[model samples]
Target: MKEISDSTIVDVHARRIFDGCARPSLEVVVTTKSARVCAAPSYSDPRSSGKYEIRHFPNGGVQGSIDLINSIIRERLIGMKADSQEEIDGLFLDIDGTEGFENIGGNTAEATSMAVAKAAAASLGLPLYEYASLNREIGVPHQMPNIIGGGATMGDEGWKGRTPDIQDHIILAVGCQSTYEEMLCVSDVFHRTGILLQEADPNFTGGRDEEYCWLPGLDDVTCLDVLKQACDEVADARGVAFRLGLDVGAADLWDEEKGVYVYLKEGIVRTPDEHATYLASLIDHYNLFYIEDSFFEDHVELYVEQMQQYGNRVLVSGDDLLAGNLQRLEKMAGRCAINAAVIKLNMAGTVTRTRKFVEMCKKNGFSTIGSCRTYDSPDDTMADLIVAWGCNAYKCGSPAGGEHAAKYNRYIRIDKKLGEIPTFATFPGVKP
Candidate 1:
C-alpha cells in the first residue's frame, strides 16, 4: 500500500487538446511514485473572461502554456511532495510573479495544480473529494443547469441579429429527496421547455448555444416565461417545487463609453439605475430564486442595493462581479454586496486557491455555486471539488453534451459511492 508521505512528483507533462468548442486548450498529466493522474482547466472566450481573471494563454497560443508547464514549472516541481498543495501552489504564484498569472497561463497552472492533487489522493488510496475535504462532512449538491441561452453565448447563429439580452435561464429543483430525483426534475423541465418552444414558435431552429442550451431567439422576458411554464408543468406532474434563476451577464451589455447597458439585440440602452429597476421587475414577476451579475463588474453600489432589496428571498449573486478572486470577493463582502457567488476553479487558477475562495464566501455567510465556463473541458474535477467543499449548488449547463454531462454523471457516481442521499441546500429563509 502506498502512502502520501512517501509519494513525490516524478514527472509533469503538458499537452494541447481541444475543448468543447474544438478550440485549442491545455491538459496536464502528473506522475507520482504511486499513481498517475491528469486534469484540464475550463476555458472561456477572451471577451467574456473576467477582468480580474488570469490570462488563459500567452502570445504563443495553447502551445505557449504547454511549453511553460513542461519546462520551468516541471523543473520546479520534479521532486516536491505531491501532497503539499499549498506549498506547490505558492510556487506557481512565485514563478508567475504576476497577480493575473500572465507568465504561466492560468489554464496551464490550474490543470497542473489539479493533476497533482488527484495524484496525491490516489497515492493515499482515497477519492479526490475525500482527500480534498480533509475529513470534513459534506452534503449532496443541488444542480443548476442552464435550460436556455442568449446574449454572448447565443451569438448571431440563426437569430438574424436578435437574441435575448440575458446569457442563461435556469431552473432549480428546490426540494428533492435525492440527487437522482433532482436530476430527473431538471431534465424534465429542460426537455419540456424545448418541446414547448418548438410548438410556440414557427422559426424555432432546434438550435442550441455553445453550452448546449436551447437558443429560442426570443427576448429575455419571453424566454423566462417559457422556462416558468415548463417548470410549472414539471412541478405539477411530479409534485415538486422549482425555482428560477438567471445569469444576466450584465457586464456584456455594459457600454463603458456610453455609461449605460446597451441591449443591442433589443435596440435599447439603460442607465445603471434603470437597469437595476428592470432587473427588479423581472425578479418580482418571476419570483426569481437567483440572479447573477445583474450589474457590470465595477458597479458595486448597485450590487449592494440589489442584495439589500432581494437578498432575503432571492440569491443576488455575482459572477463577473466576483470573478472567483479573493480580493474582489473581499471588496464586495466588505460592502455586503452579494448573498451568493459563482465559484469556478480556473477563475482562481489552483485547487487550493479555489477552495480558499469558497471558504471565504462561506465565512462571509455567502452561498457558493460551483460553475463551469462556457468553453469547458470534459474534465469532471468540478464534481469532486463542489462535493468536497459542500457548495450550495452546481452549474454545468443543461447536460446536453459530453462536456456538461461529464460533471453531472460524476455527481451521480459520487452519490452512489456514498450510498446516502444528502438533503437539498437552500438559501436563507427558504425551505426545501
Candidate 2:
C-alpha cells in the first residue's frame, strides 16, 4: 500500500441524493491523488435510533449536511492524507465540536469519512476492506436476512394503523456450506415466505415494508409462525438448516408515559418483566438463534435477565441498546450479559469509531454483527466492512431487491478473490 501524505488528498465534496427509500441522504466524494470515491450515508428509524445519536443532519436535511461538508469540512480536510482515517475522523469531531455530532451532522461526517476510506483504498490499489484491515484471512460472515418487517418500517396505508410492533423478522442461514449457498437459502425463504403470507391473506394487498417483507394484517406471533413455517418448508426442500431471529427494535414500542410495551395490534401492554417473560417464551418456543433489542435500549435490567435466561441458548444481541457506542458497550460489558453487538458505521460517526467499537466487542467476548441502516443505498460498503472486520454475521435486509442484493453480490466477489471457502458460524439450534 502507498504511504499516506499531505499531498494524497485533492478535494472533498458533498451533495444530496435520494436513498432507496426516496428520502434525502448525503453523498460525499473524496478526491485523492489517484482516485475519486463517493459514499452515501445510511439512515436509522428515529424510534429505534439511539438517544445519543445526532439529529440526522440537524433537521437541516441533505442540504445542511452538504453545506457543512462542502464548506467547513472541506476547508479543513482539503490537503490531508486520505489514509489517515483516525486523524481525518478526528477533524470531523473537532469541527463538529459536539458529542453527538450536533453541529455538522453524524451522517455528513460518516459519508465523508467513508468516502475518504474508499479513496485511500483506491489510491493504494487495494479493496476497502483490505485498506481498513491488513488481515487477509478474514472469515466470510453469515447472512441474517429479514424475512418480515413491521413497526416503523411499515407504512400506515396498508394495515390502517394496525401494524406489528416488532421491527424485523430475520432468518439466519445457519447450515450453508458457503456464502453462495447461504444466499440461495435466504433468497428461497424470502420469496417463499412472501408467497405463504399472500396465500394466507387474499387481502394482503402485496404491500411491503421498508425491507420488502409482505405487510399482512397479522399479529406479531402470527408473523413468527408464518416465518417458522416458511423456513421449515424451505429447509426441508433444500436439504439445509435454518434458524429464526428477531430484531424487535423494542424501543419503538415502548410507551414512555404508560411505562410499558404497547402492542397496539394485539391491544395489549406489558410491563418490563412481563415483556421480558414474553420474549423468553418466544425464544424458547421458536428456538430462536438470535434476538436483538428484546427490551428497550435503556432497560438494562431486562437485558440482563434475558441474557441470564437464554444467553446459552441464543445470541441475545443489542442493537438499540448499544447503538455502536463504545461507552454504552463498556457500561454493559459484563453487567448486561449481552452475547453480541450490532455494529453500524454511521451510528458511530466514522470508520475509526466503528472499528473501536468492534475491537471493544472482541475484547469483551461479544460477537459483532455488522448491520446496515433501515434506509440503505445501493452501496455494498457494509458487506466489505463485515468481511474485513470478520464479524460473525451481516444483516442487510432481505435477499430480493437490488439494494439488498448488492451486498450479497459484493460478498460473492470477495469470496471468489479470497480463493478460500467461506465458513459459517456455529450457533445454537443448528445441527452439527
Each model's lDDT comes to 0.85, 0.80
Q: Write the per-residue lDDT of candidate 2 for residues 368-420, one digit (tens) a residue.
A: 88888878888887777788877888887778767788888998888777765
Residue pair clashes in candidate 2: none
Q: lDDT tens string, model 1, 99-215? A: 777887777778889998898888888898888887778677889899998877875435524767788998888767788888989999999999988876668978888889998
**Worst lDDT 10-window in candidate 1:** 423-432
Index of the highest-lDDT prediction: 1
Per-residue lDDT, model 2, residue 358, is: 85
Give the top-scoring candidate (TM-score): 1
TM-score of each: 0.96, 0.95
Q: What C-alpha lDDT, on a 0 to 100 scale, does residue 183 get in candidate 1?
A: 90
TM-score of 2: 0.95
Candidate 2 lDDT: 0.80
Name the runs in model 2 displaced over 4 angstroms: 1-7, 156-161, 425-432
